[model samples]
Target: MSPSPDTSTDTSADDVMEALVRSAFQVMGVMTRISAEHDLSLTQLRVLGILRDRRPRVTELATFLGLDKSTMSGLIDRAERRGLLKRGKNPHDKRVVDVYLTPAGHELEQRLTDEFRRDLAPVVDRLPHHQRVEFTRLFEPLLSPPLVIKPRVTPQR
Candidate 1:
């Protein structure tokens, strides 16, 4: 695990901002190395991880990945060529195409996820308790959209 930054002394707002960007880069550097080892970009790794559960329309995938549709198409094309994923007509809708990870792709994604979890556990564990909690409180919402509840349906006599 990386050593935690010393936060004991008085610090200015500018210092805090710089520290935040530095820490973020350190984390990103680690991920970049991991991605390189697997011959994938971080974005490709994320795509495989997302496809582990269920297949989705290409546009849906694009939206979820925060990528434009045309950009997503090229990414999918690359993955498809690498035999990591397949594109075909959606099972529920013949008109729409969905993407799915191949077995090899799923296996690779699972392995990477497991390894990251194990490797990051110590780093996360070293975080100050309040910082750890605050990090989750602050970032988890940014990662996911706010949950929306469905309206209840009524049965009429």
Candidate 2:
């Protein structure tokens, strides 16, 4: 059976949902253009951004990026060949491969970040002050972790 209509306003929830999806696509296109200015593919930019803060195992990156292991492996291989990344055995587990950023990777990430900030700043500034504040407040929690962190010590350390 079809769901009952919201009957809230002239606009339906489906309209809102569709708008949100389209906004995501528009934002992705904008990001793609900015990334292309630096000659980086979307996936390459994503991998560099992920590696900027910390290293992760190939499997972990695959899971986080919603990519299959084989696809992740190929992406990693290409990034390595470009001198953007280095792969080595995980100190904790020899079987696991960990990815680290090279100096070139750091420079590329910095450039990408600056370009993105410049591209986004004007758009964000155009919003009303209250809306900007509220948006920043709402956005922060989405990026925050809910759990506490525990320190780990490896046996080999």
The per-model lDDT (C-alpha) reads 0.83, 0.82
Model 1 residue runs over 4 Å out of place are: 1-23, 127-139, 146-157
How do the residues 68-124 of candidate 1 rate in per-residue lDDT, one tens digit apiece? 789889999999998999999987889999999998888888888887787678878
Predicted structure with the largest lDDT when compared to the true one: 1
Q: Candidate 2 at residue 15, lDDT?
A: 80
Best by TM-score: 2
For candidate 2, the lDDT comes to 0.82
lDDT of 1: 0.83
Worst 10 residues of 1 by lDDT: 142-151
Model 2 Cα displacement at 1 (Å)? Answer: 21
TM-scores, all candidates, are: 0.67, 0.74
Model 2 segments beyond 4 Å from truth? 1-19, 128-130, 141-157
Question: For model 2, how does the per-residue alpha-carbon lDDT over 42-153 read when each residue is reduced to its tens digit?
Answer: 8888889889998899888877777778988899999899899999999998998899899999998988888778777777778999998998796677456622223465
Taking every candidate in turn, the Cα RMSD to the unseen true structure, in Å, is 13.0, 10.4
